[model samples]
Target: MNLAMRRSPWATLTVLALAQFIVVLDVTIVNVALPHIQSGLGFTTDGLQWVISAYILLFGGFLLLGGRVADLLGSRRVFITGLALFGVSSLAGGLATSPVQLIAARAVQGFGGALLSPAALGILTITFEHGRRRNIAMGVWGGLAGLGGTAGVVLGGVLVDSLSWRWVFIVNVPIVIALVIATPVFVRPIAPHQGNRSFDLLGAVLGTGGLLAVVYGVVRAEPVGWSSAEVIGFLATGVVMLAAFLAVEARTTAPLVPLRLLRARALSTAGGALALNGAAFLSMFFLTAIFLQQVRGDSALRTGVEFLPMGGAAILGAVMATPLVTRLGTRPVMMVGAVLNVAGLLLLARVDAHGSYPTGLMPGLIIFGAGLSAIAVPAQIAAVVDVSHQEAGAASGVVQAFQQVGGALGLAIVSTLSTSRTTSAIASGASQSDGLTDGFHRGLLVAAVYAVVTIAVTFLSPRLAPSPEQIAEAAAVAA
Candidate 1:
């Protein structure tokens, strides 16, 4: 490739970052708009969860498959297609007048997201050279991840309050259209590698169906009764299908997720931790947002502002953890993160109705942010450590797949548990809505317990760090 023929690095970053930012930003944006969406669309409690779940389900389900498509079909083509689909879907969602339409559009957006996100990462790693520049780029990438979650809440709150929630989806149309125009000119294309890599259709069906079943079962555990036949049947079906997927992957020549990747102790363990940690982490954002809005009756912007301190603390913690990860090794750093996360979750149980924002929420938010900062960097590092530079996109895609799936699962489960307990408490003849607060507290406590379990699992992980040789090799390959 001629140097002059290539696009500016800044242009590349702009498109890639915008792609990631939009994908991540929507997660929080929806959180902010949930009440509005529910009211506007006549959504039931179950439908509200679908608002988030629909996107994640497709995003996670199609992610590995999407990565494969980029590899086989060419990243730029796939990316442009993704961009077009996403823009159209957003328009559909923005214009949606009924619950079914909005849910369907969100699902389409997830499919587009699955295509765009991995291709964006592939473009970034390939476009930029390696070494310190790569680290800085990855930092930017990670920072955006950090900011996306935090920014979403803050910005989403402001957007929804000042503008209609429809503006949320409508806003993306212009940005994506602009980015799409720039992509072909600026975004580098992969030379088409000739091969007949088959799509694992059976694997996809089994894997996706299994995951959906497990998610449904977990979500319905509290609401439908843990012992109910429906929950058990779904859980069993999900497990069986997933197991079948694993078996098929091992036997197939081309697999969506190569079982070989799971051989690396650090990468596998880190991926699992990332997923579990996401489950715990998303719970806080969802629960706290509802608390501020529904229980405390705070305005959206106020809710956003109240959380500013947590974002800063989270940044501080993440920066602090990066250096510590170098010195202490990835597994140990993660163990510490898991511990902090549990501590935060435990403390969050103390929040009450009409509670002080700083006094009630700050402690948990700060600690949680610190925990994310510590673990997320190391986990990301571990995931890509052995990935061939050319395959960085695939690695990034897998990590994201785990995250979206974790978010969907966590949101479903936590919502179910809290809502079930709250509804039961209310129906059991509680004097007031204040009685529902108990369910939120209990949910937090359970989440804390889950955090502790994650920490304990961290002990089983390898206490390995990147050797100097591996670092040098990685740098050379990335270059």
Candidate 2:
């Protein structure tokens, strides 16, 4: 049979995008359902965070290794394997009766996503000839990924309000089933690359374990005082393990992360900025969900509906980003994005117990969404500035991983900040709603600060000339 089995490229792209869509969609789908999940599972406020944190940690931590595995074991095989794992885990999550069960399932789902995401991207890169067609496919892919993220909130709301919060996870089971069946029909099978196919098991374990420990420490600090021995021990353990991970990577033949990539000024700067951006965006969304439902007394459905405009604004920003970057360059676009994010977060910080959504959250939500997408596109481009073909995947993976890991870490810290302030306010004799609002304000203020720092980081991004080839390649790599 001919390579690709002579399958239509669009068909392959569709399959790949759908796979990616599920990966992105899972990130936010659970946010709207969080309240329902907590009530149903009787989760402690501090314990509830693990539902989201577990997924992001495993997904981000395993992502680079997943890509490397796909390269050695074939994209088609890994994609199917990931889909199966996701489907099984989603079913388990839906049926979970305890918080631990649900959290464990989410972690597995994250690992599956780690395996699925890169395989899909790898397939897309190989399927399309590297030029206009590939660029267009990647654009469609990028746009769809954003939509999937925004759509998750809406979809989760509908499912939670109408069916049950369990459906938020159950919904994925059918989708994964369909994707698995469709995979062979559309996605071309590539033979596993023949060579030294060593896996980085130690690095993956140490790195992921270290992050989990640190995030655990942060989460625990909210419930138990930060001075507690448990918190301090976890923090110390995480730091030492991370330090050890670096040492191992420096010596390993097949490292999970190539330390030399940090030497690329553009990659390092953009990666840092992307990490901060991820932190702000993820924490903002998590707090907004709680604010709308718990503080403002909105139904799950209403909260999701309220987020519609923000989602639309985000899509608009993504669509507009390419043209803006093409005309103005990455640095200017990034600066504007950073400013808009700060403005949005500041507006959101004004949310009060007495305020209405229209008067308080709507405008901020819209602007924040737009700013989030705007920064995202340019950062992706800047991260790849002057990168060679050989290092492109590694560089892209590094930044993307930073974004996910940053999001998980950010969520943990911000949740603690918000909870701490809320406790203080409530203890000070404020009304429950007022105390919650105060907490939300603090969290959003911190997100605004992160965005403000992002503005400064944009200056460090190297300028990539708007040449057609460079744009096309960078954009595709970004997707």
Candidate 3:
């Protein structure tokens, strides 16, 4: 670590958090620019979904491997390599003139993100003491996760409207460059595990293949019905691959994911809640974005601006979570978040063709955003709370992978249901606006159901506090 980082760990954290912000920001920034990209590249509606799906596929699929690699190698090394690759991929994506080229670049970008995200989180875990300081850092990290998506929508809109859609991708180049230069100076290096240096090649292959197949199957289910042969084939293949992976992990001397980790109540329960949270919250963004632009006839810029309140609410909630968790504990805070999310989604379900923003959307967005911060912050903290330093990356990866898979699966289910509703309404002679509104409302109701389930699950989770070893280690490092 450089003098600056040694002097103030917060500076190091800022660099790491900014790196995370860029990766998370990329996830949604492309949403607002999809229309421009579709027109420019002459993409069909079916093909357009690939733009997002491609990134999600690689990111989710390779996350475990990336995290494992970080633990086996060094967090600093993986982080720098990932940052450079992401920057180059972003530049390539920005300059692409064909859908194929853009999609390929996006896949590469996802791989880079898979590498960067876990390593960054691991660094944060090892850097801060597992107490108030770490809690505050986690809150900031979680807030940025919420902030990134909200900011992405707004930034994508501004860039698309004021300049070109390409600017959305291009914007990453400078940020990546700055991060690359600063990372080595600010971040301390983590040593690899001495016990097992062997790579889990088969596990990596099976896990990645399985996740990719599953996400692909989910995305495909929308265009082709769930019962379609193509969807069935992909889902089957994914299941087999994943089953094989589990078998491999159970036998391997140096497994990519230690089976023992999943046995922990706090980690397991946090994973479940994170998955449900991702399903409801991520899909809400997608559904709401479409409703704002397609159904309500709002411009991209206006849609982006309107989401600012949600962003602010999310940040506020995340900031508040640290103190609340300190006072109340993780499970209670998570339950409260789930209840708030359900209320928000229920309110949003009342939206109609003629509904105004204040009554129909604003209240729900604000409440849901706050709930999002509440759940996400604590869940993430719980995932790595008592984990050994060597396993930090892997634990973080598990939580994130569940989140990605859940988001993909939830979006598919919701999209299929909503589209079916819209198609049925249109067939019955309802106007386009009314049909769309009806479909969106139904989707929101399903999301509310997801929130309800999350609340129920919170009761089963064990209440976990920072372990003594964790606090001692953190204190030693600080001293």
Candidate 4:
């Protein structure tokens, strides 16, 4: 069979985009169905957090290994395996009979996704020949990442509101099926990269373990209090394990992160900005939902609808920024985005406890969406800048893993910040609503900080990026 050397035609883009959508949509979809999921599964109070966290911790932690696997194995084969696992895991989660069953299934789902995301990106790299078609495919791919945020809100609400919470997982069934049927025909199988290189087993273990420990510590601190021995011990353990992973990487022959790849100013700045961007994106959606429903008395459906502005704006902003990146380069477009995000988040913080949705919430979401779109796309381009085809999967995987891990950290940190402020506000004898809004405001402040740091990082990004000539040359090197 001939390799799929050209970009995916319309039919291919549609299938691949849908595939990307299914994978990412899973990440945010469950959040909206938390209440329904809890009631259905008879979960313990803390079980809901686990439902989300288990998947995130596993998915984020394994992405680097997963990415490299796509490179070493054929991208097409890995993609198929990942998709099959995802479909099966979702089926299991949907049919879950007990709390343990659900939690375990969720972990399985996370593992499947860990494999799926990187493989999907790698497939795009292979299928989409460099140029306008590649840009559009990536835009669609990037847009779907934004779409996941949108689908999470609308689909979760509709699923829970209309049918059962299980449908959230079940909906993916058809989508996955479509992709499986489509990929073999549309995506030609590439040769397996049987380089002399060996797998980094130590790096995998250390990296995965270190991230899990950090996430565990962050989550534990919320319920156990900051001073609790469990929280402190977990936190300490995370730091030590992460440090050990770094040491191992430095000494290893074929390390997970080749030191040379870090030399590009574009990659470093984009990576740093990505961490902060993750903090801002994850924290805002969740924290705002809490403020809307808990403090301001909005229905679940209403709250979901309210976030449409952010989702829509993000898509629009991303579309608008693409042309600019082609003309102006990556750093400028992303820097502009970082500026908008910082301003918008700060504006969100100023929204009063008694503020109405149309006046306060709508504007905030719009600004944020615009800001998010601008930063996200160019940042993605920067992360994979000038990477050899052999390293395409690894490079993309690193960015994806950082994004997931950073998001996990943000949820924890924001939860803590909100709790502390809410406690202080309550102690000061403020009204219940006021105290709750105060907590949200404090969380937004932290989000604002994330945006600000991202801006500074964007400025640190090199103005120049690899030209179209250079990117096309990359594939030639691998050949």
**Highest lDDT scorer:** 2
Worst 10 residues of 2 by lDDT: 463-472
Ten contiguous residues minimizing lDDT sum, candidate 1: 470-479
Off by over 4 Å in 3: 1-14, 42-50, 122-146, 181-194, 386-393, 463-479
Candidate closest to the true structure, highest TM-score: 2
TM-score to native of every candidate shown: 0.91, 0.96, 0.86, 0.85
lDDT of 3 by residue, 1-479 (tens): 54864637697789888998999999889877776787889975446656776777678767877877888898889989899989999999999999999999999998999899878877887888777788678667755765787789899999988999899999999999999988867777788757677778798789878877876787677667889999999999999999999999999987877778889887888888988998897668767877787778887788888888888898789778756776677788899999999999998888765689987789999999999989977777777777787676567667778777677667666766776787778889999888888888888888888899899878888775544444333222221
lDDT of 2 at 151: 89
User: What's the TM for model 1?
Assistant: 0.91
Model 1, 281-353: lDDT tens digits are: 7777777766677777787777777777777877887667656766787788888888888888888788887
Clashing pairs in 1: none
How would you encode candidate 2's per-residue C-alpha lDDT over 1-479 as one tens digit per residue? 56456368998888889888988999989999888898999998778778998999999999999998899999999999999999999999999999999999999999999999999998888888878888889888987888898889889999989999999999998889999998988887888878878888899889999999999999999889899999999999999999999999999998889999888887887888888899998899888888888877788888888888888988888779878888888888888889999999999898786687787788998999899888888888878857888888889999999999988998899888888998999999998888888888998898888898898888777765466567668888978
RMSD of each: 3.0, 1.9, 3.8, 4.1
TM-score of 3: 0.86
lDDT of each candidate versus the true structure: 0.76, 0.88, 0.80, 0.75
Best first by TM-score, ranked: 2, 1, 3, 4
What does the lDDT read for residue 430 in candidate 1?
70
Q: In model 4, state the lDDT of residue 199.
A: 67
